[model samples]
Target: MSYYVRERLPPRSTGIANRDQDRGRPAMQREVHLIGGTRSEAIRLAPVTLAMREAGLLQPVMIAAGKHTGTVTRTLAAFGLEPDITVEGTGNDTVEGTRTDNGDDPLLRELDELWSVRTPAAVIVQGDTTVSLAAALAAFWRRIPVVHLEAGVRSDDLSSPSAQEPDRRLLAQVASLHLAPTPLAAMNLLDERIAHTDVLVTGTTVLDATLAVTTRRTPFQNPAVAAARTGSTNRLVLITGYGSEAGGEPRMAAAARELAERHPDVDVVLAVHSGQVDALPGDSRVIVTGPLSYPDLSRLLCEAYLVVADSDGVAEEATAFGVPTLMPRDGGEPAASLTADCARAIGADTEAIVTAASALLTSRFRRDAMAAGNTPYGDGLAARRTAQAAAALLGLAPVPDAMPVSVPVLPSGAHA
Candidate 1:
């Protein structure tokens, strides 16, 4: 038997120290490179790429997986921005590379090659995926500045035995510019001693993405949304779980049994990741579906009365879609604070989850308020603002102002 070690070497930030000494340098036109670990990052980057092109800033380059290359390419084409570079054969997604023990993986090598060839002035990496971390590392080694989108989220209980805590902590340390989505996220970054100057509250680009897609309405007008609009005879609850090790399967099972027993009229749909379908509970009412595209998921979300899951970013996505959500306590502190009506602390017993779901299904006032409260998180313009922020950071001429509105703070203990 052979043993292997999997570790990400700490990033080298001192690579550009001497270059910083050379002041009064002529302004140089810079390339804005996006390193995507998954299809979602590529999708999210589309609007930013369009906004950059419209602003006449540097052309954007996307580094994504071969499996997702076509999807990424088509998405960019829809937005009318062609990638200057595309790298393939990483795996099904970026997480494949992160979980691999080999430090000299081809994807990492490709990232290094991309950095060497493009030499971007600033690199924009969205979210906290493994690909983002790898790209940040590559940029740091090359002395290029890094801008992290959706930065500053924390779960605080790393010892609680969750994988996201390590991922988020590493991302925070590597990023040069932290583009946080909320004041709470910004505050979290500042408390971590990241300079206030380096952190900006840009709101969430996902919100912007959500608003743009939802406005189209054709998708929402489909049968699924219509069915959802009809309301569940028993409550229709959506539950999502990610990462096999994070207690997702067990939690979903436990919650399902409790809900089925306590509220037999309410139906529970478990949206298992395609990879984890075998783990799904065998209840007829506990419908198991594979992963869905954003638009399709948003449509489903529109119809869903409530969303239950342990996925970090999905809760906010649900909020943007005006779907009330209940998140496991382990999801993260930021999401918990944002979704008072739906969120319960991590250790929520089966009875507690059942109680929460029952309350949400019966209360018209709670549903209305939750739908109204989700407006601040995202309005589907994050891609546009993210584009502007990326351009400005690259020292390009300022993009025309289309800044998103500030998210309103929820009253303390309002959801509880």
Candidate 2:
């Protein structure tokens, strides 16, 4: 059964107002629009949407374009979130397929049409995806306030180095409020001449969502899932990558084979993207699988001895789990991964990855030392804080204390 089928959205008012002011009189609920399209954006928005729903402070109107339908579906389902509206079939191909030949133009038109008749008090968007930037622009055009989540992430040069940096900068220009994840991010916004009042350090929501997923309580039904649980002799080595170099399936296959060969005892799980599945290496030791659901991926990370990936989200999630990671990116690393040597940049060279994996695998002291360092991400309270800030911004009632996260507690006298 669909999780969203059980949850219903709250009533909405035309304008935002402070419900606290009208204690005796009934007050109308305001609608806060939350939009996302890509996998990363959807993952980050999960906690915020859940928070809004739990608080009942404001009615959240969820929106999405089908950029990553599977990922978006899994993530939203994990959090029991369903979009109030989707802009997929007005014109052009569905968001799940090709994103070329003026792909985003149709999305822009759809969003513009949505705003033409009914505009929310504010539009909340996450990350630097094209869909996010488009939504922010649409809200800005309608003179609706834009709330940018995970804002102020800077790349090497804002000259379209990876397409994300430019999108982030443009979103910053139009966003009325910027919820930066770190101090460096806040400083970046300030340096860009954004008002200090508009910028708030709410930490990253990814960690909050990552921590929320607990180990399965019931007996495993799937043989593959049951086998993925790490045993005494099994050391899990998880790999994920994107872009031209290591992101290619052939390159990832080679790296996986190399790692498996070097460490025969370790179990290598490679999360292959859909585009590169055809070239995946067929090896018994290396488990080649399609993109994992967020919960399953979180479970793997929690059990992984070492991670070799180029994704920023992977780096951040690995850091929160205290799992040592090898970043295969050529240039700069994400801010969360660059602390206490938690993540190391080794380019896309297969030899470098094997060497690093070997060193970390053999040296228990080294891995333990790095894992003990402070997480560059936030405490597990990012969702609550972000939700609180959003309520304050929207003039809604304050968010009540959130329920504590359910993690597996070790038996008394057992070490964490």
Candidate 3:
């Protein structure tokens, strides 16, 4: 799942901290190989790479690693990055953009082989995808330090139908540095007996990407989606990426149809994850489309009246824009998935969704109050903090101040 390439650095096998004290080594020998994940997760690491490269403290090797070649490549290109080494899966190896198991054993072996020849000083990974876990394992096996970006995120409901839950927990075992997105996430690592110094609360990096892309507006490819933003009487209930868990599930679709029926004035755009279109509602007001490009998605969030999503990263984005968001998981979401201000954890039941939807729709004050809440996500400085943490892990420079993150206000209770 992970793709890796170096800047032709002479492979240094581990012992990075010791090597740092050595007389000036070429920047290549200080290579910090960053493995690219999905577009959402990859953008989080993008700022870190740019920071590191700009500092000239360590060689930032951007590697594109994912099943969806086009998606991965496009994401890298978004930040003016192209993987020095690109790994593409063909035949049964490849999968759609959404994360589902695509046999990472081969990725493990491939990374193992690459590192055996030319090892990076440290390997950086993001989130809890197979690509992140595989990169961590491969780096760990070689005694290379693994820097985990967005570490210590755990779902409130283990039975919440997300496949990547365990991957984050297991990642903590192998990671040398945990760049937790929130103080709550950092506390989760500390509770597990991880060293206090090893965890840095950097806030979520998605906001950085979101803020950057929001400046660039693009016409939505689907006319229906574009129309949702323009109509004065129409409110956009943007449902982003039902995710791998929502496939063949009628509950969400049924809920969407009911919401459409209840509110004839609003436009409900169901931007579904690829390969899960079969479960879409049959209502005319519920405009269904495949996954949206990052720019289009950002534009929708800016223009949306309300948001409903299950993808873990959208919570951060919704918070960034102060958009009132509803997490549809029945078990609720982790602390990172909700903000103090505008988000609520509404379960997957049809009636519950409709009730929450109706309340948000009927009351302008409620929606505005949610929007007025302070963003729990970062003030867009997470990447700079993350870059400093990665450098400090190599003993090259001091990590920038660990920005304070407020403990998330969970609906039922704290995720901690």
Compared with the true structure, what per-residue lDDT tens digits does model 3 show for residues 30-147? 7788887567666787777777877887878776665665677787666677776765533122144334555546667777777776567789999887778888998898888899
Those runs of model 2 whose alpha carbons end farther than 4 Å from true positions after fitting are 1-28, 66-71, 89-104, 215-225, 228-233, 274-283, 397-416
- The residue pairs that clash in candidate 3, if any, are none
Candidate order by decreasing TM-score? 2, 3, 1
Q: Could you tell me the TM-score of candidate 1?
A: 0.72
Per-model CA lDDT versus the true structure: 0.60, 0.69, 0.70
lDDT of 1 by residue, 309-333 (tens): 6665666667655566776653344
The model with the greatest TM-score is 2
List runs of model 1 lying over 4 Å from the truth. Answer: 1-30, 65-84, 89-99, 102-105, 157-174, 218-236, 243-269, 274-287, 329-336, 339-342, 346-352, 369-379, 398-416
RMSD in Å for all candidates: 8.0, 5.5, 5.7
In model 1, the worst 10-residue window by lDDT is 1-10
lDDT value, residue 193 of candidate 2: 96
Please estimate how well model 1 matches the true structure, expressed as its whole-model Cα lDDT: 0.60
User: Each candidate's TM vs. the true structure?
Assistant: 0.72, 0.83, 0.81
